[model samples]
Target: MTPPASLKLASHEGRAAEAAPGPEAALAIRGLTVSYGQTPAVFSADATFPARTMSAIVGPNGAGKSTLLKAALGVIPRVSGEVTAFGRPVAEARERIAYVPQRASVDWDFPATAGDVVLMGLYRRMGLLGRVTGAHRRTVRACLGRVGMADFEGRQIGELSGGQQQRVFLARALAQGADLYLLDEPFAGVDAATERAIIDVLKALRDEGRAVVAVHHDLSTVTRYFEHVLMLNVRPVAEGPVETAFTAEALDATYGGRLAATHMDSLILATA
Candidate 1:
């Protein structure tokens, strides 16, 4: 059954959380809560992302998808929570995490070329007084090449198309040489080709024994793109492998009646 364009879900049955021991988790969050003055954004959320896997954080708008990412990263203050990256406190493992924020939140007009942007990712390794060296330039080129933006390194960021800019930002994150990647809506506004390019790089990273997590809004791509999923509606709804957790029941719970009955039916039938 082909669903309407409005219906966006992939077929996957819910499964129990794995009980067997595995490798150390790439990220863990316990009792996470965030508020905006008088209102709570995320409430006592708990999630775990495993090593060498790609996970998607999915929920409806205003469900605190981005809020969860920001709070976990300490970009925004959390009311209560314990977050760990690779079994260590976030502060202690900061260098092992690379973050790519929503493209819309960036200041593209800041006078910098694509190469300059990627070079920023290497600043930590260069130290306070260290200048850009030949090694750094090679690294920058390599990162850009990985994202297929090598030729555009000299282009001003503000002058590029939306997809081009996104690729450059991803290149910058790649230059960080982090073990875990956190991306907030990496595919939000890009052409199919650019989206393909980004996901390919991300999957390759996961295959290399790194972890990748993203605040993903498109349900159609959830099971296809990620191995694990964290469903949310302010608080956690369900979480685990996409094969088991990306079920219609989880979507209904996470969306909280926002998805119509017709849509839900379509999802079930399509998946069935």
Candidate 2:
């Protein structure tokens, strides 16, 4: 389903966030760089994800898509650059942001129930030593219900299917009560039904005027699920509306000499 053509980006850049144009952006990163020892994962790149839009960070493997998220969230130390949320420093705005890492990165065997995982999202708001009050638990339960996992709260996450586990994580993010959601490939391995459900939830978030930025690999579905796109390959290739930024030219630059047809072929075989 294509979005209404009325969506715009100027309001996003009208703030004092950066000279880059967008103001009051849900997330704004400038000159972001990350490296490990002598290896540079990402060079200077800038992108401002506007509120009320879903932006897909698209690129080939090793384009530093995941690194950008990690660096911005401070999960990993950055080499240099700045990341802000709602025009505030990243740390100062932490409480208002929720991140759902790739499902593969978790330890499924960890002895934790679905509810336990969802409640974890509240750690920042609750303070490191804060207790989980009954009200907080109720909120967790309600979040699970919103994601269609109310009945599975007590189930072990390790025992759930991939799709179910993803839903549980989505529920956890909802419990964060955030204004921005950063998801790393939420649709990578989900079933068709699960994919549809996730997209619906994402669109619902956008409807409520939240920003959703995801690291996505599916060229075919990028346009279908995202309203805006930030094409990346170590550095930014393009950043704008999905229709405008996802052109053959930009995609070519993002993939770095990799043709769009080749990527389409790979995607077809991969999903097959």
Candidate 3:
């Protein structure tokens, strides 16, 4: 499938092109292998993510999808290999990348307001002993507004609905002003409206030449929401454009026999 017109233009201009292998990828994982104790979680995974595209990491349960995202963000201990961002080591590029973990992974009762959570993103920019200035507040407000959470600024995080909470976290990621976004399950357990809103926000980010990688399920939405897809089952099953990687055969290989059979039937009907 062809990339969107905006991505094509960016490629022609040599600025934030989705397909031009941006500066050796906004994020690169090479020979990356991870293990927990004696059991290996990911094995010899290698991938490059160019800028100005939305990439989805899709796989069945226990496929190490979340583990891959965490390892890329340096949140998990790797047993081997390397992860680099913008041609720099992970540590050096930390400030340039933002991570939004799974909603189920966070404690909603952490006693922070939505604005407070958003402000956490500014910590990297503000040194120790630096107070949040009016400028920072304005930035947070703007980011909240962008995610349609302006009125929720003062609301406690635990009080929010599942979708609202997800939006709040996305606003926090926006506040970081990062060039790369690593999001895990941003669409799980949300209302349909919230899902659409998140997709729109991600598309906008891609248009602005930022790279966003999401650990996503829901095969039905994969092709519609992402241009690139990484299919995995504890290893790299496939990685490329959604239309290329999200095929029945690839899905069958990643999801095992039963689900793959079901998905193939669905794919046939969709095409027919």
Q: Candidates 2 and 3: which is better by TM-score? A: 3
Error of 3 at 56 (Å): 0.5
TM-score between candidate 2 and the true structure: 0.87
- For 87-115, candidate 2 gives per-residue lDDT tens digits of 78999998889999999998999999999
What tens digits encode model 3's per-residue C-alpha lDDT throughout 1-272?
32243243335346533455553367777767889888789887776676678999988888999998898777998988777887789899998899999999989999999999999989988878799999999999999999899999999999999999999999999999999999999999999999988999999998888999999988887877887888888888887777666788888888876485766778634433
- Taken over the whole model, the C-alpha lDDT of each candidate is 0.86, 0.84, 0.84
- Residue 37, model 2: lDDT of 79
Where does candidate 3 have its weakest 10-residue lDDT segment? Answer: 1-10
Candidate 3 error regions (>4 Å): 1-24, 260-262, 268-272
Residue 207 displacement (Å), model 3: 0.2
For every model in order, what is the number of clashing pairs?
2, 7, 0
Between prediction 1 and prediction 3, which has the larger lDDT? 1
Q: Judging by TM-score, tell me the better candidate of 1 and 2.
A: 1
What is the overall TM-score of model 1 with all chains considered together? 0.90
